[model samples]
Target: MRDQTDTGTTEPIPSRLLLGYARVSTDDQDLTNQRAELHEAGCTKIFSEKITGTRRDRPELARMLDHLRPGDIVTVTRLDRLARSTRDLLDIAEHIQSGGAGLRSLAEPWADTTTPAGRMVMTVFAGIAEFERSLIVERTRSGRVAAKARGVKFGPRPTL
Candidate 1:
């Protein structure tokens, strides 16, 4: 008769438990849905932030990063919640990758750094973000030039 269970001959599926991070710019935004989504996505632990993403200090995000260990996975409902700027997003991604962890974005289904295609997508996003920044800089310059042409002061006025 064959044994019903394996005699310690089976391999584990590499515990890929998900860790969730959620953020909202203002208190007005509801976090109920975000928490539910993270739970549904298999998040054993969820870290939430209620402050603006533009701020240099995000206590929840900081705590999440510190808590993460190698071979773990971090998830977010959307990328914007994690980072507001392209540079910030890229920085965070790099940090996660360095820690031997992967990032998954629920909203951006294509953003799964665990696959080759996902890495490609991230590279493309970096390029697009750089282009967007350049365009903004150019537009600002043009606007300033137009304003000056209309006799608008660029700086504080001199006292008489």
Candidate 2:
């Protein structure tokens, strides 16, 4: 929807449309609380899914992304509920931004990209996550080297 201002300038108004996404890892878990929270957050349309976050394919998430338009906002209860890792989160953020939409997490206010401060915080978080991943990789490589020096064999064991 477009709104015209009195200044004779046709500016696209931010859509009040809040789209909510809620996900649970297992079949035993329920989306009731998430759905309720999303509704409370003024989300007129909510998409719920039950699946592991580690999986690369999330049909509901994909559907929601595809459904978003300019001025739309995507809300989730928590950051983890939206993505499994920093890389994944950044990828999702890119998609949302490219679509001219924003993303917000109820539990993590700093993740709200619609605000300048939130964007800064999210950038810092991304950097920290990347650093942590690098450290992990370095430590893993060091451990492998040490094991090799100790004559530890790599790969599958031979059958007797």
Candidate 3:
């Protein structure tokens, strides 16, 4: 995204942008502290929402992701406020990376993808999360197989 001048000139956009994202699980929750923290962190724009993290469709979050540009950093008050699970976080992080932006959590420095070390840490975490998910799936399959062998049934109960 380039900035255009009045004289028909085009220049690269701002050196960088610290775009903040604040979320609360419910409407009754307050966003004051998150907003203040982001402002103090030099964020020029902030996107906020009052929705559960478990929901995949978040309007404000989607808007923020769409607004991302190269050299933009998405800041969150905490990782849990952005995603409910590791896979969710990784998916959102992948989207941000694909948009040429970075992600940073104020409360979890290890989750930042702007720095080399932080990126490595996140990569390692992603790998671990994937392995854990695979293990869980395997265990579930095995459990189901064993249950079926014992004459245990699955699915909803029969209707009249």
Give the range where candidate 1 is weakest over 10 consecutive residues by summed lDDT.
1-10
Task: Encode model 1's per-residue lDDT on 1-160: one tens digit a residue.
Answer: 2233467555554566689999888989988899999999999999997898889899999999898787788999999999877789988988998988889899998988878898899889889988998999999999999999998987778888
Flag regions of model 3 displaced more than 4 Å: 1-14, 155-160
**Per-residue CA lDDT of candidate 3, range 36-92, in tens?**
999999999999989988888999999999999988999988999888898888989
Candidate 3 accuracy as lDDT: 0.91
In candidate 2 the C-alpha lDDT for residue 15 amounts to 60
| Inter-residue clash pairs, candidate 1 | none
TM-score of each: 0.73, 0.82, 0.86
What TM-score does candidate 1 get on C-alpha atoms? 0.73
For candidate 3, list the clashing residue pairs, or say none.
none
Per-residue CA lDDT of candidate 2, range 1-160, in tens?
6778899888877666899999999999999999999999999999889999999999999999999999799999998999998889988997998898889999988899999998888788778888998999999999999999999999999998
Q: TM-score for model 3?
A: 0.86
The lDDT of each candidate is 0.88, 0.92, 0.91
Rank by lDDT, highest first. Answer: 2, 3, 1
